[model samples]
Target: MRPNPDAQSPGPCEAAPARKGGERPSRRLLLGLLGSTGMLAALPAAGQAPTSAPKASFGYADVVERARQLGERPFDADAARIPESLSQLSYDSYREIRLRRDKAFWRDGGSDFRLLPFHLGFLHDKPVQLHSVANGVALPIPFTTALFEYGKVPVPKGLSPSLGFAGFAVTTTLNHPTVQDEVISFLGASYFRLIGRGQRYGLSARSLALDIGGAYPEEFPFMRALWLEEPAPDATELVIYALLDSPSVAGAYRYVVRPGPTTHVDVTATIVPRKVIERIGIAPLTSMFQAGEGDLAQRSDFRPEIHDSDGLMMQAGSGEWIWRPLRNPRSLRIASFVDENPRGFGLMQRDRDFGNYQDLEAHYHARPGYWVEPQGEWGKGRIELIEIPTDNEAFDNIGACWTPEAPLPVGEASEFRYSLSALSTTGPLHPYAQTQHSFAGSDLEDGHAQGQGSKRFIVDFAGGDLAYHLGDPARVELAVSVTAGSVMTRILQPNPAAGGFRAIVDASLPDGQTGEMRIFLRARGRTLSETWTSSWTAPAAAAPPQPSE
Candidate 1:
């Protein structure tokens, strides 16, 4: 489903500071700055032509050297310099500023990709330097208001022509040969969003995550600069290099973006820590989950399910596939799955039925899921999932990433490489059966006594060899295990409607305790489905009825 072009909501990251009169910028406003031919026809080209090239040749190694040098110096918290007028603009005023399509970089160069720069204002106070690299020569793209059409926004006086840009978006002939559709964007801090054919914006990917879900305050790293390599007229891929900076670390990144049915981004990241970093997240993915099948009773909304992602999928180094359903927890919750030489992990939106989410404007079903496949051996790390409490769907409260066991050494560069794919289906990747749906509630309706602190769960397993065993349902068995609870009962039954098998389990846990439950299907000692894992917290027994009242 394509998202409404004018919808207003917070992005996948933290909400930006409120604008004047307490209004905030919408996610659409932040990610949807596409250029229009009608608006550009009357505007003139802005900024000066390319300046003289730098003395040395430009390449990925150059960006690494720059990052290393940057780590040696004190971190600059004031690098982004914006005039008060631009910084103080309201959300409505900021949305009025649009880039001119006729003046877009590489528009007349016969290249398949056109780069549009974002104007700095509102929540995007940080300015990132952009450069066009061609023939080993990197030329800086200067900033100018002449490239923008300020609708009703008043032009600020004495604006600097060297103020630089907030970030940029790349457009190509993705859906049609004559029309350009925005395939990717890099804006805000180190956050970026991508879409494939017939997909809409949903989650976001970050360059690096520091001290996330730790005791201390989390540190956000920003992209200080980007070098876009000029693409060949017939090029099928676009290469980009980025410099990342934060108080704890400085890093360099290279992205090879290929747009197709499933857009894939090949990423190479190298970081040098200024100090010993205890917690660092690699290939971090951020998303939103307000409510889903498991928590339908908790939601009062009209839509059945409203979320960008429904579950977390992982392939551990030990060749075990796991699926953990996401939730909007009552409090902050962090779950870790340890592994070595991990294969892949991602946040997936498996429920594609539009009826599940009746909101046509949001198009939650069309949101793409991103899978991270590690390129080489990443020894001794764990995939961490952090779910925060949120009452509204506007805020992003889901985060997943890989955290290494050892702290990064000071002043030493650490390198990691991975491929991220924005896809919709997981059948091609998973060999075993997968979890189709899951629900948890009390077991009263099943005639089982409402035992104190007991909860019942129903999990459906589909696909894979489950179809072959449908004729003989007695051969399948349900395996259940728990970390801090006791399984009272377990039953496996054939689900002819779904061409799968359903497992029902009743478990008991101590009051106020949280436990992890793992379930799977097996036949003749052969595992048939991915492990379904979930965390359940038993509600504390109600205060003894307050007899005095």
Candidate 2:
């Protein structure tokens, strides 16, 4: 999401200021910047370049040194020279400035990819330095209004052609050989979005998440500068280098992006903090979850469901796979799953049926899920999911990121490496049956549906061996456990609607009691599904179970 132009300037990891009621930017106006493009013959000839190389030789090491040096000194917010006119442009006026495709960075030097810079305006008041690296030399990409087509807004008179660009997007022929598609974009502080062969932009990935869901206001780190390595004419992978800056930390990042059926980005981050950070999040994911089928009673919309992601999936250190269904809670809720050397985790949109969304324009069903696989053993941390209440679909209220257990020491470098996979679903990891849907309702007590005494949980599991044992409920067993109160009844039966087996759990809790429950399916001494877990809380003033008389 783009930052609010009037919001306080902070790090990208910080919680962004809430967008208020206004004529917000249109989806097409925001994403239409990147579209189909023809192939580039090659990188432009060196002699024809507009500017010479910078003093420092271009490489990953150079970026790391720059970040370290910057951290040693006090943070400077005004590093880039942005024009006052661009820094004060409104949302509608900013969108009017569109990049010219023919003047793209790698326009016809002979590469399979091209780069177009984002204009600095609206929420992007802070401009970032962009450079093109070729033959071990990094040359700056000078910004000019001539590169943009001001649709309705007039360009400011005497506008400098050297104002730094805000960010950039890359166009490539990953899916189609001749037709170029915008596969990845970098904008809005440290936020970036990536799409695979057939996926559209949905959730976003951040370089880091700092003090999110904490008592104090969060901080947002920004990518101040970036270097794009010139790719060969037949190169399949693109390498990018970035310098991250914030009031609390400074860092360098390298991303090796490979676009394919499941686009994979190998990331290496080296961070050094100016002050001690009590809580820092790594590999953060931001998404939206307005409503789903399980919460249909709470929604009054015509669409069956509306969300970018439906659940949070994690692989714990003990090799246990856990799936927690996401909800648009009535209030802010933060849940943490502690682990050491976690296998992986992600926010997934498992429900792919188009009918689930029914919106032809948004195509929410086609949103891609991003799973992060850590490259090395992270000592101890917690995967935290923060869900905030939101009534509309435009706001992103779901945030998932890994918080380190140990405090970050000042003036010391901390490093982490990971790879991200953009996929349709997280089905390959857990070959066993997986939970399809989960919902809660009033339980039937003595032929009466009692809403206060007992609660019923319905969980459906599909795929894997469940397909082999269809209609054979006798072969399936439900294993249930609870932290408090007792699981009075449990049953397993085939669900024709889900094309799988459904497990039902009915439990009774004492007043003022909250219980944590776990459920899974077992058939003939073999586990058949990933664990379904939830934290259930009873109403504060609910009456206790009455004595049988």
Candidate 3:
């Protein structure tokens, strides 16, 4: 089955709030990667097959060098390579061609990890070359019909034996030491997703994003080839090397993935541009933001919320924590949070209550929040958040990436290294109070102090000292700011039920205009919470809410 774009199950554990329990590849051989001269020493021929003896040597240095050389030449769009039969297969028929579990690489060899390669069909007709490496030699994974269990679909008699893999899934005893479970997958373009000890695959990470949410058409880079390094018998971490190619750039990527309570992937990539890229994105992330507490009126579903992520959180280099609640906007919107050197940023799913989603099958609460922590100073870049209008939860319309202020120099290599954390919750990292939930609504009551067109923002903060020092919450003060419009009232009160504090901001909007608002809690001149930010846009016209199905 195609990876569910919006609904991947987390783990078996029930999610707790931030204040509570919620507070949470391979290598090819030498010649292919390193080129001819840089090959490692040849191994002694001992296997039965003399004709297939180890060829040239390969390593990460060779892959980077190859990428640099490839970028110097014009990109070759290798289309028409997929067989017509495979391309014409329907989605259902494609799903029928499943990889046989028993035939997985290393499964029967008593290794800690197993690899399953995907068949080329349906939307993934562009085959990606996959290689397995052991003892410094690389061997291309050969394609064979026997590798798959083709349910009822008939395989063409004359299909080429040279067909390559589309992508692959790696499995390990992630859930339990004795049980094999899918830990991560690399499929389709440059998209890949992973799960921690308890995380289900929710969002995906891209090796690089170019021209996303820009004026011109976007470019999608694909994993041209991949090398899977043979893991030791009892290895805990897996290594993968990939060559990425697109019209504008070519790249070499290395991922050191370790699955744990918080699965961490240490990513290192070097990008060599064929052309100057004005809008390049580093460590981009893709997720869904169909509707959340901030824009629940847009959704007519029975679930209180339907989203893979609810907010964008950034820890700026200035030590300020910024939280931007995601929205299902009426129009495509791009928000940029400029910074000189960002500490970190991520698309977070803060609300973990199952009641909020009520999706028994989807299990949105278990979806992990993906955080990007730069390994070094990335000097002068903006965290770009792109929100696209969507009518349903199926589309992954929310994107966050780091965009460098200056364009990438053509023919020169640029590198970025970062650690990706698949977090169950951000509470454990932040020492101060943080936003757990936020909601917005029109203040329509006539007797209310605020009149029509005035909006009320109710934000909840939990964890840290919020529950301790805020016992008399009246002592807490709400720090509020607005780019436009006027704030009518701002108040902070203790939420005994949540064991936290709630801050409310009431503001009157200008006719047919939009305004930016920011709010946070401070007690006795000390910052008590992350700054909660949102954009208020006046609807062109109001429509009656549709009844839930």
Candidate 4:
């Protein structure tokens, strides 16, 4: 998900009103007041007497109450104000300001998990409050400049203790027992990235999506506060609570993170909309797709392929598996699959061979795919895919999410629960033969001119029950259909190298028009492969060159 420089920041935790003469309460006094309420731990002065108190209980219910109260008031867009020095830092300068690992939370607590706060700057100007929850007590983790090592960025002198933080990252002994590796990060709005063992970061999951790829400008809701529960010394999972806020809605989120070969995050969210939301996306995923096998003509770099994800995989309520190969279209493309209850969906990077990318620095082959499995009945909704044209991979141009058929009720709470998995390989997820690769080009070999809008597509399906039917190739039939075009020729043959079957189709589309083509394999009366779908946009004829006067 892209960052919004103007996104609203979360309001600060409740505190005493400003004193007389428009003077705010001192940090020590505020801490003292909070200490009395058992909401914060105050540090004793150099010579002052030690002050101790019982800690108050805190959990998901507390955050839900905060969100509900936040929704009742108008959103305060000016809650966070970044210093001019920090707000003006360039990307390179911002990178220089790194959190010191030595000062990380729970660094010496005998726990496997560590939390590192991100300094506020660059695209992440809004600061979010952080708290540490131990036993039943919640203590705010106050921000301090000593927690960061500012290399060259000219941080102004005497920054306030309440400056807060842009976000935070969670690290653990994911790869090696002694080596700490980052497993998850909450940064830039409601976006959070995850990676499993032997995998690199790619797509991101969002708490909610509003008016994305719609007529109205998209809204970015951000995490205003986060409370991390201290894990046991031998705990394998970490629990986190977050307060999300935007102009249209406020939400409370709980994430149970478990890191392993395939990392899993169990998410539960309760959202209260300030008004009726016409377009809301749940279990939203964002990624990048500059160019891939299906659209090789758009490639400019030396790499044969460039993309975080190559396709969108979905399991419909009817139990049918469908794979739609992603494309870097010349224009904006939006496709929606209407269903009552989607089993699951994800943006997958099916092509994992390094040779295809040839970019050692990027290591695109190692990017992990994220699958969202709904925990409860999502009811009637449509899985929407939005592809925005991009010339380079620096920008994320692909988005997918489930949009409910009915608008969210105004001033009422709606809850959604799902499990997100960071997958390196998804062969076991599909029961039928999967689409190995897809390629398309002009159908010049069949006596069709290159510019005549006739195209040839070669799709390979491998694995599953295809091997059992390889002995009798004739029994396997190819099923192909086009929504706005005509199929000229279709053929299915055994691909011994793939241990499955290959289907080739020659289709013609009207000039300057777009069409969708779907193909699958079947034997007898049973389907033997997942449906492979793609879209094609016939190029418009070039205009005749005007003669020079």
Candidate 5:
């Protein structure tokens, strides 16, 4: 689902969190992607059957040229390149149609991976060309029923065969011979999500984001064509070169995916902008945040929480590790953390307990936390977190990425390179206990809302040295402060059942003004726990509103 907009902001993902061992398309594509029927019908009526030499295929180098040439003109996306039959299917019907395992191309080629084209529908209507590199020549992967079995939907015969691919999914048969595991997928816009072993899909990674969180209409770039490097028959690794295009920029991307206990993917890119761009988000993540225990707004659901990611985890370049809980807000809010060559950042689903969510079909605990690490020194810039107001959890409301310290000059080419991992944990898989949950309400003796300027913040700390540090945690004072507000009361107590400590920090603002609060465990001022920071704005009656930090 989505994050709760009203909860406090979480920090950037820290370390390299990978799977710690704990954690569809459809139809009318029944035809091909490239329009082959038109070419066949145009051929002369000579008695000779319509026969032709291999058609020219595009390659990785071609994508570079396209980006360079695009810089001379405006960017344009051609989603219509796909046929009508493929783009009209619904979600349920699309899932029913799938590529047959036995008919996968290069079945006898000694390859461990299979290439399945995405069935166009819903958000993935853009068509992209797919190619296979084998004997030095790149060949097109054409569409045909041999690859998939259309369930109940009737086939529309003579529907000009267009043999193009919407996108591609790479599968690995490491553990199972008859079944293939979907390891990576590149579909819809410049968005391609991957996973490490044991990690379930949770967040998404995008090639580039332009004008994001801006007052103007947002721009979404799409991968128009992909040149898949032909894998050796015994190849366990795969490389995919892609062509990214949109109204603002054109770029090239290369992804090398290696699957295992901690599956990793190395991503390299060279971008050529069509024009000036002030806000360019690299390694952006999209997730849903609906509500949390802190949220007093009651709904019909009985579950305690509902969200895809809990907060943003970031390790600043200065070695300041921070965790900001996510929130589903009532208005648009953007948190920008200016930094130079920041260590790493990610949107993490840190609260991994089955009891946190009761939905069996939607396994919230299995979702992965993807973290991005820079390969080289990226110059001065800030990691930005954009939280959009959403009523339902289905829509992705959280966007986090690196916003360059300097703007990309107009009509000039810019280049950036970064390596990222899609993992399950928060990084280093450390044994450090963390905040299991954050709850809030008016501080009263018996859980009743009290009209006190001292707002209560209930925080649950789990994992660290809870057994030894529980009762009367000496030196563990509640360090609480609020900008545009004041701290009225504070207290830290023991939760024997939770086997952890709880802090009830009660604070308030002088008036209805924007307030920022930070709280965590600190003993002898040595920073006993990860810092929790958040920004909140008072209601109109409180004061002039300012978005959270």
Candidate 6:
């Protein structure tokens, strides 16, 4: 299934060169340069002048009703048909087809923020219903070429009006007084992503996930209609309403977005499946983890580490915490943590070392770390982690969600609600310390493979005042367990560089089989660290070298 476009920053790849009237190439041309961009399709537009949307009384119940109605039928989205002139241009040309800043909704004299629509073309051919709320009723926001400057778009001789906007973004002063940062964006499917101040965008959150990562493949749900609610004249918050549609499920999403250094949004959703679903992933966060602490020595990148998030940080019902280091393994892997009324979980970006990613433009280090905090009891379920092995970072191969122990049956309905906050470092409780690093190498001495079926593992812990107690390194104890492997030498040592300690262990498995292992560190006889667990899988045996016979 196609990724929810809202979460990913599709490179300004559609960036076209300067054209006549300062217009750039069209989305069609630029997308062709990158790849064939997919669109949901659109209907014919009515010939008319653009108009403002009327106000409508809307609330939570309206949201549920929207989902319920869509669930009763099949989801069919029509891609927008643009005038041929715009379609023929390159990415830059299409971008040059700008929406006149002067035409911004409520820009003249209404509020500090104004509504600016997106141009059609490229992956945005799908026409989405955009509405504005004012007074008492909600009215449709009509479309017309009058709202935009063709630039070099070469508007066709006769084109229809009501060719609605592609999608929209909210721009506000994030840093400088006059600088408007594109904070929250709703484009592409039932997906939308946001970024906080001082953070670059990475990863996305979806309206709903239907049978994700399944053998039967997955179904992507797209948002059909959006209601942009202009906040109270003095309000700093922004509100949006979205209707999500797909073959399996239909849903509604209400987002109240507040942007800051730790941009946060309160998401409330109601999904009604047209049919029963085998799996419904809720409060899900999608990210990429190429390689990190646990297996850094195993990665091929020049940097010491590369990932959007480091590990799964769990604050359990019993008040204990757990941290599972992320792994980019040989195949798709899913890890689950079952609990009753979970506190919260998210795909995090813990390692923020700019040196980790040397590239200047794609500041992977500045990517935001998102956290999901359940507003109420979620019952028994698993915090599932699905890792799809990749040799690159272009794809988001890491997925973490709450897979309910209970599945919503076909033709049946269920409701789940939670709040997710996109955080840089504010979400998680400042734990006394964290496992800073982990290393794995041959168990043999002199760096040669001497011990058959043997490997040595090193783990480091840093943060807080753990180093001040250096005189009591011997007093530190470690609880390491090998659930299904054989162990030999284990040592707890100190690393002066990171101001932390390390847990070194050696293990052997019969026939090079795979198993699960768990380890933890304790200081001054108190359980000092979260449990560090890993699942090891045997690599597929390589083909025996073919000999000329």
- Give lDDT per model, in order: 0.81, 0.77, 0.74, 0.79, 0.64, 0.64
Ranking by TM-score: 1, 2, 4, 3, 6, 5
Best by lDDT: 1
| Model 5: CA > 4 A from native | 1-62, 77-80, 92-96, 154-163, 174-178, 296-299, 427-433, 442-454, 464-472, 494-500, 542-549
Q: Mind giving the per-residue lDDT tens digits that candidate 1 earns over 1-549?
A: 011111123433355456677875544444343222222211124344565538457999999999999999989988866788887877668778876645667777798888877777766777788888877878777776777878899766777656777778888998888988778878767778788888888888888888777776777788889998888888899989999998899999999999988999999999999998888999998888988987876575788997899999999999999999998887888999999999999999898889998977778898999999999998998999998877767677888999998998899899999999998888888878899999887533343333347788899999999988999999998999999868988999999888899999998887777899999999999999999999888777667666674
The superposed Cα distance between candidate 5 and the true structure at residue 246, in angstroms, equals 0.6
Determine which window of 10 residues in candidate 4 has minimal summed lDDT.
35-44
Q: How far off is model 4, as Cα RMSD?
A: 9.1
| Per-residue alpha-carbon lDDT of candidate 4 for residues 124-197, written as tens digits (9 for 90 to 100) | 67788877787877777666666566677665677776677777778889899998777987876888878899
Compute the lDDT for candidate 3.
Answer: 0.74
At residue 365, what lDDT does model 5 achieve?
A: 74
Residue 115: error of model 4 in Å? 0.9
Answer with 2 or 5, whichever has the higher TM-score. 2
Cα deviation at 487, candidate 4, in Å, is 2.2
The TM-score measured for candidate 1 stands at 0.92
- Give one digit per residue, the lDDT tens place, for model 2 in 1-549: 223332212122223332235454433334443332321111223443545536555788898998899899999876754767776676567656765555666656588787767777766776777888887788876666666677888876776545666777898886798977778878766778788888877777888877877776677788888899988887888899999998999999999999888899999999999998877889998887888887876565799998889999999988888998988887777898989999899999899999989988778888899898898998898999988877766567788988889877798888899998888877898788898989987444542224434678999998878877786778888899988877878888888666689888888776456788899888899988899998776555556899999
What clash count goes with each model?
0, 13, 17, 0, 45, 30
| All candidates: TM-score | 0.92, 0.89, 0.86, 0.88, 0.80, 0.82
RMSD of 5: 9.2
Q: What is the lDDT of residue 57 in candidate 3?
A: 67
Model 1 bad stretches (over 4 Å): 1-16, 19-53, 442-452, 542-549
lDDT for model 6, please.
0.64
Evaluated against the true structure, the overall lDDT of model 5 is 0.64
